[model samples]
Target: MAGIELRKVVKNFGKTQVIEGISQSVPDGTFLVIVGPSGCGKSTVLRLIAGLEEVTSGEIFIGERDVARLEPKDRDVAMVFQNYALYPHMSVRENICYGLKVRGLPKAEQERRLALAADMLGLSEYLDRSPRQLSGGQRQRVAMGRAIVREAAVFLFDEPLSNLDASLRNQMRVELRRLHERLGTTSIYVTHDQVEAMTLAQRIMVMNQGHVEQYGTPDELYLSPATVFTARFIGSPNMNMLRASLERGRLKLPGGTFLPPIPATDAAFTGRAGEILLGVRPEDLLPAGENAPETLRCRVELVEVLGADTLVHCALPNEAEGQEPIIARLEGSSRPGPGDVIHLGIRHGKAHLFDPVTKKRLAV
Candidate 1:
């Protein structure tokens, strides 16, 4: 398997630019996920790498050779598309071996690779079945098997599991992860789903308006997002961003809640003051007892019970206008209903700081 690299790649359709000048070097056998909102150019980047779409400017490399001008077949990259691009007339076996047949590989070599791919994909018994007879997941596996038999230098997946049901999507995620573990192929997956990006990617490249917002491990993106967009986009239940600023020695929220300076947390903005932000995760806000330190008094607006835990949707005292209720994850047994007043304490050293002007996280 060979790594893929994009050097200042740019793609434009007339006056509308899709991919901006983006550069990244993915190491050999790395699982890199490109994720962003729809129309953010995530899929275009994947297509460019697959040689399905020509780059408007700059270069693309597979291993050591530049393949920007090469045809799709010569790039040695197999792409699994979103729509399950399978031949309806071909049986599973024929579909899997189509690439080998076109390349005029020997019958013996074709059978060997087909068998291995089928067995690995758990499709051995369904080889005689047509695409119409297979389930969505099975058809996806067949598409994957076709790519597998190619034994290409890189594997490109363009939202390959988007057609499956939620349960099947989860199931296929596990299967795909296992497939990567077994093959160790250099793979690039494009998807708008952050969960898929978080779970499958070794390094996630979060794209925004065709620019790279952040590129790092899941933990880095989650705990230390580069920008406010990354902070809001990467986490589940979404991080609560309160409009606040550095006061005499603390952070003051719109609700007039003042959080004392935790040296490490405040060092990044010691002298700076104007408008700043405090990013609080749901789990970081705890249901505190009376007289608890570093706690903000809030009135519960709603409660959502989710078996083991309950989500407390509440509004803090002196909250700013147009502020959405912040959610705090508490134990299922600790139910705080609407209108119930409670104190929510912030976990020490857990809050994130961001600049209001640049909308980027403050490095501490």
Candidate 2:
């Protein structure tokens, strides 16, 4: 196994750029995920690493070797694609060893690899069954089995679980994590699903419009997003962004709402007094308890009961007419119906501030 590196890598499709000067590194034996919405160049990055797509400029290295110009077969990396890409007539055992056979490897080595992969993938009993005879998840395992036999220096997965049903996808996520742990191989996985990225990645690189948005551990991205796009994109229910400004040495918000001034220790809000975006996650808005410091009056818009907690979507009192509804994740099953007025206390310390013009986080 080997670490991977991308230095100022760029990809262009004739006139338009798809991956723009992106650079990142994956340490040996680490699992890194490239994640974002569609057309974000995630899949393109995977292809570039797999040597399937040519870089218009820059370099890609697998350990000490620059593989930017190498053929896919020469990269010493195995890729499991979104589509199963299985040969329908081939039995599981045959499919698993096909790559090795094509490479003219000896029969003894091929059988040894095939047995190990089949057992690891729990396909031992189904090894003689054709691809058409297996289930979706089974076929995916076969695809992985094929990659495993190669014993490549690196593994690349391009939304490999995208075709599976929700339950099966969830199951596969666990299985994939276990497989990576046992192999300790440097792996690069690309997916649009944030949930998959959060659950499986050792580190995540969030991309947008050909640009690298942020790259860090899942907790780092979730707790301290580097930009508004990441703040909204990473978390469930999304973080709420509200218009804010400095007024009379206090923080002013839409709907004539006023809160305590930004902390004097927060240098980011100093020497700047214009439009900024205040970001607060749903879970940070708590139901008013005893002696709540800062509270907002809101009318419930909707409620989502999730057994352990209830998601209350509410709109602020008269002052916040046109703003998006605020969501609060409160403990227990106290469901509030539409039109019900509730007071929510703001956990201001947990909130974030971003520069509206740049849409970037303003560190305090």
- State TM-scores per candidate: 0.97, 0.95
Write one digit per residue (lDDT tens) for candidate 1, span 1-364.
Answer: 7988899999998999988999999999999999889989999999999888999998999999999999999999998989889999999999999999999999999999999999999999999999999999999999999999999999999999889999999999999999999999999999999999999999999999999999999899998888988988887788888778778758877777677676785566667777887888888898778786667788899899998989999986555574546889888899977999999888888888888889887877
Model 2 residue runs over 4 Å out of place are 260-265, 289-293, 317-321
Candidate 1 off by > 4 Å: 319-324
Q: How many backbone clashes does candidate 1 have?
A: 0
Compose the digit string of candidate 2's lDDT tens values, residues 160-213: 999999999999999999999999989999999999999999999999999999
Please state every model's RMSD to the true fold in angstroms: 1.3, 1.8
State residue 218's C-alpha deviation in candidate 2, in Å. Answer: 0.5
Backbone clashes in each candidate structure, one number apiece?
0, 1
Question: Pairs clashing in candidate 1?
Answer: none
Best by lDDT: 1
What is the lDDT for 70 in model 2? 94
